[model samples]
Target: MESIARQSVKMCPFMQRAGSVQGLQVLHNANLPAVARKCPVVGHAMSRAYATASGTGARRATAPEPKAGSANEMVANHATQESLFDYDGLFETEIEKKRLDKSYRFFNNINRLAKEFPKAHRDLEDDKVTVWCSNDYLALSKNQQVIDVMKKTLDKYGAGAGGTRNIAGHNRHALKLEAEVAALHKKEGALVFSSCYVANDAVLSLLGQKIKDLVIFSDELNHASMIVGIKHANTTKHIFRHNDYDQLEEMLQMYPRSTPKLIAFESVYSMSGSVADIDRICTLAEKYGALTFLDEVHAVGLYGPHGAGVAEHCDFEAHRLAGIKSLPDKSVMDRVDMITGTLGKSFGTVGGYVAASQRLIDWFRSYAPGFIFTTSLPPSVMAGAAEAIRYQRSHLELRQLQQLHTGYVKQGMKELGIPVIPNPSHIVPVLVGNPDLTKQASDLLMKNHKIYVQAINFPTVARGTERLRITPTPDHTDDLSDILLDAVDDVFNELQLPRVRDWESQGGILGVGESDFVEQSNLWTEEQLSLSNNQLNPNVSDPVLGNLEVSSGIKV
Candidate 1:
């Protein structure tokens, strides 16, 4: 450890060397007992190194402590041993001089580029660029109704909510918004957080504390927020492969049936847009007496007959999805244990909410540090979100438009030889093998074609699975589709990337494209025969239910 420390110091720049020297002085004058109490080898070695470098007397190690805790523990001594000039050859990099003689070379270069190459990295806004970078699913954020609602709230409530939820910030609007969220998700109570990331991170940590011997069966591809929550909880967790329901069941069966377990996952996985097997997973949770936490951040406003989400509406209980009893307004009066959603993405605002039993809401209010430490969301923002949700729920046509746009884009990408993950929802991704190439493609799209799609890279995605994430929203007109697809073709052609086989080409070879592949909608979408409803979501309904033409037809 000492030698490794020495090597690390040697590699460090001059200021670090100076800090180390000062640190050694503090250690040297400290009583021997105190030095041994903290770190005998580490402290003593640092002291010796500093002294030797200064051409002082031969240094010796500190003595041992008799007891683990003593008055000497706090005392640290430093004798003036090394002068700065004597420490030659100790740092060969001239790191101190480099640190002292800092010029604005990096910033100057940026300034030079800003002037000499004004048009090189010019703003594309003036050029009328089409963007597919934001995760605005329903594209309702900028909708006239949504914008009007936000404006009304801003005009009425001013800007910030002013205080924490429990304090002066507990406005009528915030309460009404929580009630609205709970009603939307069909739950008993809902607690809002500053953001979905905070909701995930704080809730799981609190649950881990409340539950005994909590064994978390987390989905491997759960968002980073969920991962952080599980970690902060400091409980043993098993990560099942992404969307692997059977593997999850196997792990669940291994645990003692009575043990407290949590099967955590997201409904609409944002990156891949692959939903979980809701019914199967829910049934397993019931069988094993484990609780379920499903994140519907990507699904809240676009699924079900009224957008209640896949688990209650789509899953194996398809019949229940349409049943009057399972409806959002009705279900809240009946069942639904837990549900979480974000206000930022589809809601067109910022924050997150958890809907569960009243008891759970009360527990989170008292225990969640994320909530306790931070100020509550402003009333204006909450009011704006409430309006967005109401408008989104009422605008069925807008939802249809979003689904249609996604279908058109996904199909066009496929025909253009882009390898996209088969998904049943609006989020579309074009997988590019190399990260550098993926970023280059993003740049090329923005620079040459005035189209913007982000290059999704690790640790956001697995290695070799990096992609240009495209989110086709209701606002993204069908007219812009050709521009995106053509730009992708150009970028890929320039990069010498080979065209990979997609579902359509693969289906044609298997003699299934026109015949056996004619399947109807499953749990993800409400539309029956829309192009977006095709094989993207593999959970097809039984063919006997209705004669659905899969080739081309808009159900809505």
Candidate 2:
């Protein structure tokens, strides 16, 4: 109901000029008689102002309409055209950009049974490809015992958990698995979630939001799930440089001693294969009076005396090497307030859990929406996971073999003049600085050599840091190892990728020597078993699989 004069004043100069007649016509077409009635006064004033001098007397003027094919007419017509509705255009743009950069991810179809394990070849279009990248470190998914237990549970309970845990979905196998996980970490209690992703997301968000004036100190390279949880909580968070203890301490010192703070980090960074300094980090946590949260997804079932994780492994080594009868006053695991891990990786099952004090777990159980609203894992999955964990806990041969294979592959790659990223962990990453060359090497390896190593690019890693992540398992024989190294060397030669300088002459980034490597291999063998004996129950044995003897020393 605004006056036309007032509306005219608010419009642009071009619009105001056009409004005298066009606005009135639009109002008439729209059947707005009330608005039209109010506009006549302004229209008349405009007409008078535009009047022209005539022979007889001054006469009102008529504005000339735009001619057909004129610029003005074309602009008017273009303005009437419908706008493009391109909701998916952004996604297409991203895909096109990635394609141009040669960073697009193409999933290679791999069909194989885990039981076939390291020897199992992936079915491609017309060839069987050798897989070099897999998180299933031990091939526990294909274990006969795990499969048997899963099948039996499936027959008894059928598929699916019927309802949410609060609504009669909780199964006995899940409870049993939880208990086993709690014992494995030596924690007071544990809670299982659909996966480690959900566990991290739920727990972090809940703690961040519920705690009073809580500040989270997170690692710069923490996994995406933890990032999501911390973001959802909308609490103040400080991100220290990845594994930089000095930066972490500096930030912690900025806050008062009474402030409630939590330091969250991972045991092993997946891409770089860099292990965190858990002992030093824990010492800082104690000094700063901050709660410690450790994510051992990549380390569980691969490190430690009983495959608990790096924290336990560090503690066990300190005690065993010192020839002490009891554990140190406080180990890394003892200092940590919470531990998070996944079953999908080493356990070869699908689930995640958080091990902590009973009260902390109960709080998560009662309040975490991700856990409370979702249906629990099926009985078969829980049973299989429990069996896998039990089988892995007692068996040291697989772990030893994996370590030996890792060392052998790394040594072979170095001998072949390949630039492998230097890290103390078991993972080996071949550096391919350019995205195009990285993809080219991966394609050549697959098509020409029948090797499958996925090219990891941005945003998984920084743009120039693209590389091929390789995991060597027990099933990969020495002959296969030679073949893999030869193929990699050929690809690098074809692509002309730069190699790191020889350690003996140039003292390159990884200065490790032959003696150090042997000592490390031995550390995982005899020393690990000796330490495990001090903590693990010697009498415990699986009735179905029987007791596994450790008489044979570690063999590569």
Candidate 3:
């Protein structure tokens, strides 16, 4: 009898739950005769009388053949308001708001020529412009060796990464890339993702979702990726003001030392160029029994002895003396629980990664959907990324020259009374204080000077704090710097934009034009900057496997 009852239920084709299952309803609705609706079973199915687990009769406005239409049908009938919701109108209204606020993002058609480094063409091949705002910190994007490896890998493996890492996508390139990343940060293991944004989102969200009562302390200035991860984490979160260790400690004090907590911050806040006190933050994390999740996206491949970023840069001398291994106990890099970075920037490739202890990385690899389900980066990209990292590891001159170039631009800006928001790092953010003018300055530079520096505006930064963000590549010589400086000065004068003294008179905003704006010493000190690539530890050139093979599930 029980077996018969089970079979009856399986065979019965009544409305399963609600109208949202439109395909099922459509299947039966098309087959059932009108008289079939008179039958009790058919009637119930047509009316969707079956109870849903949620005990709600409400259905999606986009589903069902009865009244609610299917997603495709609604989109097809979007010109009419027959559907319950005006889906198209909602999207249009949101976009219109962006346009009104002067925040509508316009995608410029700038094609960067790899061989020419910062030189790129606008629209036409002949319309050339110097890209002054690229995040390619080390200019490794144009490195011949990196390109050669990528081209070779493309020839051998073809384009796509077959599939996700667990599938055919897993290959030697993935292995070597992860290995290089792990070694770069002196971590035991690493996991590559589609992008660092995905990496940060996956790691933080997975941590919060998995750990019960997990609390995340995030810096206000942390990237949107981290912010999204924390939001999806769906747990308690305390947002500390940017780099406010004291506030972070106070928040941590609320939770017991044994409570699971994660502090997410960046080594260098990209917009402001502010440097974090990694050692101090590490100390606080230890005292509070919290794990540190440092986003080194902007810092990696531009800092430290071997391009490991600010955390490694924190213990610069120590990392420089020995290879990744043999660091002093709990060195800054060692102290960070997880270090998430991008290969797209200084590594000159298109992928992101997180490096950490073997166990933590394994857990992230096994659980984080971003890594587990997302398609692996292409073999050529992985190969190019690995080679970029490896090449940069032994070459300290790139980072040194990058810093030197940044200093040159900053000095020239100062001499011209340009309002450069000062920082210790290589980024040069010139405050325009108005979004309209910031855009104007960017357009003018590209039009008149053939310099492509993108304007930074809200919601990237707060309103009234718009600026022109410039990044100086190692190859942007003093001659180019002078041209850029001259053009910027001329633009500000033409537009009547506020100069440093202008803002100083108006009472300084965000360190600009402030009488007390403290000048920060560059991240690389004069003594450190004086040293050449020859001084970098020889072991950096040696492939220190660390935990790459032991922990990698890819099984290369």
Candidate 4:
């Protein structure tokens, strides 16, 4: 509570001997610095900084703090007190909003029976349903050999990987599995992670963080994992329209060629069955001096001569003709700097990987906390996944059959006046524009028809684009197709869902029932489909495919 006047009066030794007015006049007459005049101890030179009369740049030395628990301190403590925020209530309100909007998800207990292939039991062992929305595109999960390999390795290596790779988890199985993944994408090296979700998140994050001023150009409709990784990277980002290369090019042009950039996209967009032009995107990346990050999670075991993915499939004939050499010429897959894929989907195991140049792979292996801190996949899974990749690579028949099944479902849906958002890949997306109806339709399919097709709602796909994303494997045969088609027809009729005609009448959306919608030819051409496994090149080696004895003999 000491004033400047009182401080000066108290500070001056002369003021103690002389009267207050006479002592003040003596100090003023001495012409000391304002700070010195205020207190003899402070020797601040700038009068403006030490000025007692306040104006701009006028500052006062801080007063000493009161002792703890002093009566004067009570007021200061009261000023800092703040009420607690209702954090749990905030979560409750957000969840309630999702519930009210019908975007809330309710999971079904559908346990897929390995023996049954495509048909799964729900809750009870006997309570079965036809699975229409699983991502096991080639049905390799049902292969007895793959299962046997997993079982044998499981018996040998135990249930879990001991720890992360840097600890006890690094072993021959991990190396072999990584080799298979690298060979699948024809990359110099590959690094495995707990899941592809983690792989995308880690790789994209590392690129943006390590490379200074790295700008990421992501597809607007990219998977949530990529988007999350981009956000975590905390760098400049431009989201181009989904599959709109022109907008992407324009944005790329705005940046100098020397500027570090990355174009992150997916090979096959899971929601709409849409396929990206991998070659074209690669070309743009090359032109703009941008690194390409392709997520082939959905397309890996469903495309290319060796089931490498859409990038490899872009030059199918060249790869297929390469035979023993693997790479006769540079390919779109080769040009792509990084490719991420899952062992869980087509490979029928559970993990993810990034196949890239040796330096990049090594960099991630050393730096990515997502990979470093997490437990490694069990040996059985690694073995099984490697087997699946080798199995699919040798069997071109599986991809063909999957394409055939997808075609059948799409054809049936079109013929039945069902609103199918068309694309060239092996996905059958039956668009239901309303969230409530999408949920209702998904529930009804499982309840009445015993068909399980999970509803796609907002956040996964955009609003008003809710759909039932159907995935057809090689095992979904003509008989099963007939059943699925008939059940779907009945469900549509009962639900009174909009048909193709209805969508067209409403001016169409997402390529569904649009009057000017261009019909996309299937990714697999007629000639390609006609050629079978018997026509495959004889010189190709199958290093990763073997029984237990040959486990360590993998050459890939």
Write one digit per residue (lDDT tens) for candidate 2, span 1-556: 2356447546735436646566545434443322322355654653444453232465534335455335553222222222446869988998999899877889887764565555435543445777788888877888899999999999999988887778875667877787778767867678888999999999999988899888999998899989998898789999999888999999999999889889999998898888788888888888988888899999898887567888877876553343212344766787789999999998988999999877787778778998899888889998999899888877766777778788889999888878777777778888876788888899999889988899989878888778999997767778888999999999988888767643334343332322233222322555553443334444334523311111111124
Worst 10 residues of 3 by lDDT: 73-82
Question: What would the per-residue lDDT of candidate 1 be over residues 380-495, giving only the tens digit for each residue?
Answer: 78877877776655454555677777889988987877777666667787877567777778778877986767777767777666777888777667677877888889998898
Per-residue lDDT of 256 in model 3: 91
Return the TM-score for candidate 4, rounded to 2 decimals. Answer: 0.84
Residue-level lDDT for 225 in candidate 2: 87
For model 4, the local distance difference test gives 0.84
Per-residue lDDT, model 3, residue 146, is: 92
lDDT of each: 0.66, 0.76, 0.84, 0.84
Show where candidate 1 strays beyond 4 Å: 1-30, 33-74, 78-127, 315-336, 501-556
Candidate topping lDDT: 3
Candidate with more favorable, higher lDDT: 3 or 4: 3
Residue 171 displacement in candidate 3 (angstroms): 1.0
* Clashes (candidate 4): 0
**Per-model root-mean-square deviation over C-alphas:** 13.5, 11.0, 9.1, 9.3
Off by over 4 Å in 2: 1-85, 119-126, 317-329, 502-526, 529-556
Clashing pairs in 3: 15-45
Write down the worst ten-residue block by lDDT for model 4. 545-554
1-556 per-residue lDDT for model 4 (tens digits): 2244457678666445555664455345443332242443354433334364444564545445555435553333222222457999999999999999889999999899898978899878899999999998888888898999999999988999999866874777787887788777877778888999999999899888999999999999899999999998999999999999999999999999999999999999998888998899999999989999999999998988778898988888888887435576688888999999999999888899999887777778778888889999999999999889878887998999999988998889889999899899998999898999999999998888899999999989889989999998999998899898998889889989999989988899998878888977888998888887767676545864222211222244
Instruction: Report the lDDT of model 4 for residue 151.
Output: 96
